[model samples]
Target chain A: MNREHDREIVRYRAPTRINHWIVAISFVLAALSGLALFHPALFPLASLFGGGPWTRILHPFIGVVMVVAFVLLAARMWRDNRIDARDRAWLRNVGDVIHNREENLPEVGRFNGGQKLLFWVLVTCVLVLLLSGLVIWRAYFSQWFPIGAIRLSAVAHALFGLILVCSIIVHIYAAIWVKGSLRAMTEGKVSYGWAWRHHRAWFREVVSARRRAD
Target chain B: MALQSLDIVRRSATTTPAPQARGAHSGQVAKLIDVTKCIGCKACQVACMEWNDLRDEVGHCSGHFDNPPDLGGQSWTIMKFAEHEHADGSLEWLIRKDGCMHCADPGCLKACPSPGAIVQYANGIVDFHEENCIGCGYCVTGCPFDVPRISKHDRKAYKCTLCSDRVAVGQEPACVKTCPTGAIVFGSKEDMHEHAAERIEDLKSRGYANAGLYDPAGVGGTHVMYVLHHADQPELYSGLPKNPVISPFVSLWKGAAKPLGLLAIAATAFAGFLHYIGIGPNRTDEHDEREAEREAQRLRAEEHP
Candidate 1:
């Protein structure tokens, strides 16, 4: 690679990238296994997880893995994702952002308004899922809850799971919609141009910090 | 289950209609339990274990005649004895033959996630296909009557099947056949209703004015009807829910939520696909690179100069 292309900046550190992938991988497994139980049409997906009983056994454990991994990643990103006045303006101009006319929008940062919204949504959903999951977990905690609570938790679990899945669909779609975004999580770096175009404020900060260090 | 292959009216977690014609044509049956006549002899409980070949471990009593305290995998049926004090202060032992009510609308089947794990026979007997059971215990949560017991051994749910094995071959349930006091009777649903009416009339004539048949319409009328002397309070007979309906939450979760949630998910993905085709990807081209390099150089010059 030429020196020009070598000017790529760090978007996510190695630890953050690894933790994000752990959450991603576990989320996929948990969602698929959960969908297997959610509807009979999706029942065949159980075979991918060693059939129904095994799917039942593994889904909650996968969810726990996802939750723990996500908690770590979220803690790392929480400061960077705090919403501010610029983020609100950026959110208001989401139409332009989606259409690739982001020049007039507020200077985007390390995490955009949309990304912050998704982050909070994920945190809320993961918390709900963990609580409701315990109540409906048949092998253990279910007996502690009364039938009414069990019923409520079972319904809540499914509903939140749907919301989480939908939110993740949007998250995955956003990652693909923006070019070079995937590499931020995959290789832990983003091209200088990609960072400048997508997150100009963060790009300027990183450049000044690099100059200061030098 | 052996005879139900050709006549399943409903199958749990199955969206497609079951083999319906034969099951609909078959006459639904019922077991009438006269709670007024039950001596709490526990013959029915022993009959259940013997017929199903389930021998629960010999456990100590919890200071009551009810052995094992409550139903277990090996014990599909049990007599629940409740002492009720009348308005006149006379104590009455309300002995209810507690087991699966086998509702016309079976909640267990509705809540089950496994295909064909729980099936309703044309004759209204709901039987569990343990082989298909995933052992998540959703049925226990779904059951308004709280009848299903999940086996610790196999993790499969077990409950009173109303002797579906015997019913398939034109024989009555073992419990119905072995009640020495003639407290339990099995027949066509219509015949059972008629029999219940006669018993109710007899009790009313004997001054039990609140006597009535407990068919419980909230669950579309259970196949297991009870002739209760104090039917005004089914709860008095060991916490029978006053009106058992499939929980609104369970109904919502398994019903509209399924299709609506799927639609939302599909729409989201499709929306993304359409955007990809329409707006295309937002790229960071040479202009962005030039801008970044110039800004970096300006910042460096400002710092050094």
Candidate 2:
């Protein structure tokens, strides 16, 4: 293991890490199948799921898995991801944060404003996708609805799906860009130096809470 | 079956272009329905059911003359009745045959994700190959005319094929063969247009000044045309859209939005890559490590001192 791992504090627990990966992997599968169905150009991607028919058959099932995993993951992280005055300040200084001018920005907690906003965006998109998907799910529920409503739901499903995909792209990028964030999810720990530089407020809290427990 | 293969002009989710080498002698066919002459006899509905061998569950009359209520996997055709009152205290019973329009620009074909599930013939008939259907129902949302029904039994989409099977053998559709009145006509689209014009003229002569044909240009015209007495007000005939086109939302979701969404995702990754290249990983250096160590040391000292 790297020396950084030796000097690390727990960021995500084992359950949270496992829950996050389940959501992430499910999202990737769902997005790929959804893209294959969305356009002819990407139809070849369906081959990864056995073929077009199988892709269609599996996409909604994968979505259900993703949504369930996400709910569990979100329930745990929701408190940390809540936006506050400090998060607002962090958002205002996003340019500095992006450029690694950490001293010029607010002290970030477990999640900064961008991450909090992304969390809520994902929640909203997933909910809309589930609702709209049911209405347009021809095999089961579509006959019960008016055609006009199904048409609207189709459009809404596509739009929300696209938004969720784009948001996840950014989420993945942020994890990779922030240096030690991947380890927090993968190994459930982050170096003290990493915690101090990126999430100083969270680092302080963790240290104080440890002292109190001692 | 081989001849049927030669006629397909478009196939949904198909990569290569469909066969287009057929000679110019094959005329495009059409169905003409004269709303002015219709008496809502429901014979066409009966003929369609008989020809297609579909027996939908007998449904109760749900406060409307339209039986079997709405289109379904089995019920390909229905007669819609609208009671309209003219400004001068005259009540008119307007009856329209509602089914697939067989559009030149079929939204169902455009939106369908499964290959060979929905196909358009060169003769202007859109047909569904049920065996290839995945039953995702994108076609249902894509249809501007609100056609296409997914069966509860097999979960495959169904719609008016314009009797492509019958047409393949050079016979008129069963509905046209069975209509008591000459309200339903089947011929070459060119011939049907001419017939519709004559019918419109007769309707105009009968004190219907606004009589015209309903072949909406918004869907790039349809194989099925209707000559209506109140043609100017199509919505009066049981909410037939006065100006029907594929929904703009559907268009955006299926059209430019696809490429743009892919581009947005790609651009985001590219931006992230560029940011990483420019700034490198924001790894904590020796100074950061020292500072964190010092802070921890201070916290420990304060706790124990």
Candidate that scores best on DockQ: 1
Q: Which pairs of residues have clashing backbones in candidate 2?
A: none
Residue-level lDDT tens digits of model 2 in B140-189: 78888888888878778899988988987899988898889989999998
Candidates in order, TM-scores: namely 0.97, 0.91
Reference contacts reproduced by model 2: 0.61
lDDT of 1 at A20: 87
Residue-level lDDT of model 1, residues A1-214, one tens digit each, is 8885568887777888888889999999999999999988999999999999999999999988998898998888798889899999989998998899978788887889999989899999999999999899989899898999999999999999999999999999988999899988888788888878988888888887752210
Residue A167, model 1: lDDT of 97
Question: Which residue runs does candidate 2 get wrong by more than 4 Å?
Answer: A1-6, A50-54, A143-146, A210-214, B1-4, B23-26, B63-65, B85-91
Tens-digit per-residue lDDT, A1-214, candidate 2: 8865557788888888889999989999999999988878788898999987688889888988999999998888887788999889888988898888898988888778899999899999999999998887666677789877887888888889989988988888887877888988898887788888888877777776652210
Interface RMSD of each: 0.9, 1.7
* Deviation (Å) of A24 in candidate 2: 1.6
Give the TM-score comparing model 2 with the true structure, all chains together.
0.91
